[model samples]
Target chain A: MIRSAAGLPARAVEPVANLWFTWRYVENNLGDITTALSQHVTLTVQAVVLALVVALPLAVLAHRRPRLAGPVLGASGVLYTVPALALFAMIYPLLWDPRTTVLIGLVMYALLVLVRNVLVGLQGVDRGVVDAARGTGIGPTRLLLTVELPLAIPSIFAGLRLATVSTVALVTIGIIVGYGGLGQLLYRGFNSQYRAEIATATVLTLLVALVADLLLMALGRALTPWARGGR
Target chain B: MRDDDVLGAAIRWLNDPLVWQGPGGVLARTVEHLGMAGAAVLLAAAVALPLGVWLGHQGRGGAWLIPLTNTSLALPTLALLMIFASSGLGFGNRPTIIALAVFAAPPILANAWTAVREVDRSVREAARGMGMSSARSLARVELPLALPLVAAGLRTAAVQVVASVSLAAFVGGGGLGRFLVDGFGTRRYGQVLAAAVLIALLCVLVEAVLALGQRLLTPVPLRTGRGAVARS
Candidate 1:
């Protein structure tokens, strides 16, 4: 009976056979998957790094000028609250170029967390520490680098962690515009009705997030040994 | 018939009923969206809070839960919605609830867990030394102290759920997301902007309510610059 089932006409078996075939195809295309993942990582990292570069200064500027913090942070929060897909859609026209969309979207999302964290981290620096730094004759540049940065590490790390997680997750939205990422796999899996592909991509994305979280936690621990020492 | 014509056409498109109808339709949709989000939050709290408290009080192997929650928090809500929709599950409210529930769970779980764990150790010790039963001490002491943090988590989850439930409209689930999705398909910029603006307003409103609730529930002493502090 089993043999006869396998021996049945090709059309009779194509659905079940194709399912396995698609699974194998995905397995064999591991290189494509890796490339997709690398693209995702690059997009998330570059966007986050650029956002930090921009946000850190803006945060400092706002800190120095308290009135600006409200508008700057509020605007970034509004941008952050825009749904990932909607944000991508809204920006698509101005760009009119697919290649730039991923960068644009990622950077926008990064600004949401990076800007908030920069402000929070900066503000969180103990007031006494800033006064002490000033009393020590440190200039603004040296003060930010030496005292503010170190003291703000905990909040900064928290923001980076939140930003990293958000970036990794939302980079999948890039697939909507033909940008490569794990989201592409997820989209394709759904569009093609391939359950195995969907499960595999979902699981793999979760693993990537887990790994990233662990790595960040480790970095946080290393940077703030006091936190780990239960102080 | 150059730039002004284009601009006029755009403004006219924005005024069209198809573009502007959802907000007027919001009263009906907001009920559905709120119902879904509210139920998910309630469900998540019921399950996650107790487990978090137990794990925290046990003080053994609780570290594992935090990472697990953090990892789960990273799951992309939209992708999950798409994947679930394609499984022939019949796209609509049910799938939206499940996705939003899953999205909201991690924050609730992590916050509850952290809040319980962070309760002043001296307080716990004093309770225990006074011959209080484990369950009693947890109910009377740890839970009260943890309420503010847990509330903070709920607030985060609420904001996330509100934003995420909008994605349900993408798959024909019919909420505020419907307006945004329709706006996208038709390129009605005003409708899209209006939908987005409304969603943001909804988020802020919900956040404000939750903040107020948090303030009310917290004891006055804890409410003052201490309890409900934003998590680092």
Candidate 2:
């Protein structure tokens, strides 16, 4: 029996087992586990969408005015250099909301990859293609939408793939600030010295990452079939 | 602490080698971080370079490997660190080193593979026609051509590992990250600022050194073209 600090009877620690026991434990608490998984996905999806909305226009603006691109990209790189925990702590005082910390960190991560990729993708469009579009007397808006964007989609998707992977990895850090996810399970397992729980969480996180990676690869292939063989 | 006091203390510490003392002392700490970084680079080179060479030579496996490497490159080091550390792994410098080595591998591998594969096929064929063995041709013809791009990739990986290793301080595997963590805990803003400054300076210095190395290593005059310009 494990004794309480106040001098009660001692209590026995739980026995360890193999993978099957771990699986059974997890299965018993599947509801909590699924909720945690969904929370992780929700956080990642929300952050990526929010980041694209902000970064896309910024990329276009920077492209139109080439001089601005350096400063914009530089600023984002600086933000990228700031450690995730520091970023959360830095904003904590201003926002005073723990719930948004992961969101904010994810957005910051997205900016570095997404903005640069978008700019590169846009700039990388064949000059001949753009010139021909202009020669055809297409409006600037029409050319940008039809020709420039379609060509740039490959680069944009590359950035999205990167951003998605990063977001999933970072969402794990949200566990520190009391947000729920696999990180929560990992953290709990660490504190409790529960090897089973730790392994379960870790494997689950890797699976999430692998699944996200495969999905993005498929999407990338679909969108940029031409680039498949070229690269 | 007042800004003036903090600045004065920092200036004093800069002149004080005592603050840097440890096993190898200040010099040791410096060497240790360098050694750790160097080991990681060496390990990454060993794993990534060969894999890259094979992928570059074969060119079939890249469909899976390229994206996999890219995804790995973007993985969050801190989260990974925590996961590994918490597994009763008995964390310290070794685990941190391993984690960082893994962190640094993908960029070097990806770049090396791409660079090797990208070498003009004609160059390889010509070398082979001269009765060079496949191995000899790879070493003399392909690797020489691939060196510049692979160097660039290594440079990027170096910077990344340096930054990521600083997080190891959180696991009680001391480095300059010790100063950053200590500063945060004790509210010593000056220490935090100094550590940040040192890290930034180190990154810049490493980049410059790698750039210089690239210049020295490449056999061909650096090309001034869109590809070179884009990479820079």
Candidate 3:
């Protein structure tokens, strides 16, 4: 009676079967999974690097001319308000390319933080220090490079770290438009109701994000030794 | 369809009286979207604000935890939604709320922590000198000063949540997302365009209201004279 009330046998339990099945899937499709993982990472890197290239100069300009700061930050803040999927829909028709849509969306999403941080970093330099540098005959360019930029490294890196991790997360939504990455794995897994597949893909995607974040943190530490123990 | 055709259709959809009523109507969808997003933000604030303030007041635990919270943004909402969906938790509201609430927590938590932590030491000392207890000092002095940032944090979280509720459509949920998801599914470009416009407008409205709140919360001194220029 108790056995009957328990219903299905232990072998029929969902979780164990799902685990075993996932193990088999991983064993059989290791190469494809790796490719997906790499694709996701590549997409994240491309977007973040592109955003940095554009945002850094813009940030410096804003920092130099305080009048521009409000407008620049406002524009990026407006861009940030647009939802990822909505942006994907708007861009897909115009660009007609999944990768381009995803890349552009990621870059736009990244701008607010990257620009804000760079500006903040630059402005954070002491006015006294700037005056001192001027007093010592440092040129405008030299002063920026020697004092301001170095001091800004930690904040700039903080922004980079944020942009990278968020880009990793947002890349998943691009699966709808055929920018296959670990997100594709997730989509397929959910569609097939394969517990193993869904679990593995989610974990793998999160791991990729975690690894990327840790790497950036380490890179920041290595680059900004002066900012180290001060924190 | 051409751009003009899409715009025309969307305008028609917007004007249609039929679209304004019923369970699947625009009004219903907006309410639903607000319900889910509002609940998520409220829940997140409930947990994040008090804890963040406490830690900020104590000046402990936040050094590491805040950064960790920030990193939680890396966790995909869709992945979280799916995991919860598959756990027999059913689809739509619950999973979406859970995912959004998690996404919403970080900004509020981080900002609140910063606001509380940065409250002037002299202010706290003054409160103590007035014979206030630690809790009293924190409640009266630290928290009031932290209000502007805390409000700003709430604004950020609310806007993000509003935008993200559209993801609920992906998992058989209700919201303005239905227009996007259902339209895309049916190749109804007009609906998709219309939905996207509505979401953007909604974000703008939320931001404007909250910006006013933040401005009002700013201390009187910070709004005028030298303090204003310093902040700017």
Candidate 4:
């Protein structure tokens, strides 16, 4: 449309304008593309990190106090039931900041996924291992530090991977607020009926999610060198 | 400090009769939302169910389920909706439903596959011992045993679909999300909040109903076995 407005296409306008995948669009909008991508990555990472921060202590508490697990998870479940779009809109009244609204919503949404997984990971450490550690004159803190935390790393990584990817997808809803990252570009494409922009942004979002998940999996392996190919 | 806080104003907006009775009333918008979500889930079920059931029966597709789920979870529904709308499918209900269906498929497929597979192996052998055909055993025994989990999957899909149907409004398709988009555009945050509350309640209602359905779908004997220890 900008090119058409620039009189770049006069005769073959329809074909050129309607093309869904052109290198020209990518080249012309490289800055915008990179900004959206970086913003998307930033929002996703921030949300997951915040969620992990909140989830870890709660998950530990829940793991330690079994009774708390039900309530913690139940609360997160209720929060999760609130849809992403609605959550963003709901947060706007109080915060009045678009990025914060998206951030808060992403954190709230990822909380359940992270908390549940982390709790499972911590609880999943074999009781025999803990008992054995205790029997070998290891202190409570030592048992947890040496055995439980290491064992739980895989599940925590799984949670982190899921939260990051889902948060990446949810960050697009930030478009409603004014900071939806690549979501903004996708929305712009939708509004202007620009297939190239839509397809490009969509593929980029998926790629980002894919890369994040893969990196987490690799990190999980690096951390848990003891875990070869099982679980 | 004031009755004009978001919650108070949202309540006031919800109390307005005008918001409840028009061509664009809450009732109509809600029905439209359900219609779109229902269609998407059903469409997804149609495709995913049989494939999951077959895969589970054969017990070979477990390798791909996690990857499939991770990929599906990463697919942005809004992007998919936009792509479908822009790629000659045009905007509105068709594109929205198709896009939402893409979101609904993974949970249903994973659940269906796991549900059927989780049926006890010895139970299957007993069915075969009774001379029941493979198909007959699956239909009568395995499927019934799997009903609870299958329904759980449907419940997840239903809630997800209903929650996401609000995206329809972004594409000019009619749904409760219209209120959110319009309200946001007009800076009517109260109405937006009210509509969101309504949608969240709808999700909870759907979840509860399907949860009940799952329990009902479970065979009476199996339900008893799992929980009610009748060991006298």
> Quick one: best TM-score, which candidate?
4
Measured against the true structure, the TM-scores of the candidates, in listed sequence, are 0.78, 0.77, 0.86, 0.92
Candidate 2's displacement at residue A86, Å, is 5.6
Candidate 4 lDDT, tens digit per residue, B34-63? 888889999999998998888888878576
Report the lDDT of model 4 for residue A69.
83
Task: Give the runs in model 2 whose Cα sits over 4 Å from its true position.
Answer: A1-14, A17-21, A24-39, A70-102, A126-138, A173-181, A210-231, B1-31, B54-64, B74-89, B182-197, B225-232
Whole-model lDDT values for every prediction: 0.74, 0.72, 0.82, 0.85
lDDT of 1 by residue, B111-202 (tens): 88888889999999999999999999999999999888888888888877887787787566877777676765676555555555567677
Cα lDDT tens digits for candidate 3, B161-203: 9988988887788988888878877767777777788877887
Predicted model with the maximum lDDT: 4
> DockQ-based ranking, best first?
4, 3, 1, 2
DockQ of the two-chain complex in candidate 2: 0.21
- Fold similarity of candidate 2's chain A to the true chain A, as a TM-score: 0.87
DockQ of predicted candidate 1 = 0.36
State fnat for each of the candidate structures: 0.31, 0.11, 0.56, 0.75
Judge the docking of candidate 2 as incorrect, acceptable, medium or high: incorrect
- Which sections of candidate 4 miss by over 4 Å? A1-14, B1-4, B224-232
Question: Worst 10-residue stretch by lDDT in candidate 4 chain B?
Answer: B223-232
Of candidates 4 and 3, the better by DockQ: 4
Model 4 steric clash pairs: A175-A180
Model 1 CA deviation exceeding 4 Å by range:
A1-23, A27-39, A63-80, A93-102, A119-138, A145-158, A175-180, A203-231, B1-24, B87-89, B125-132, B225-228
Error of 3 at A29 (Å): 3.3
After TM-score superposition, what is the CA distance of residue B172 in candidate 1 from its true location, in Å?
Answer: 3.5
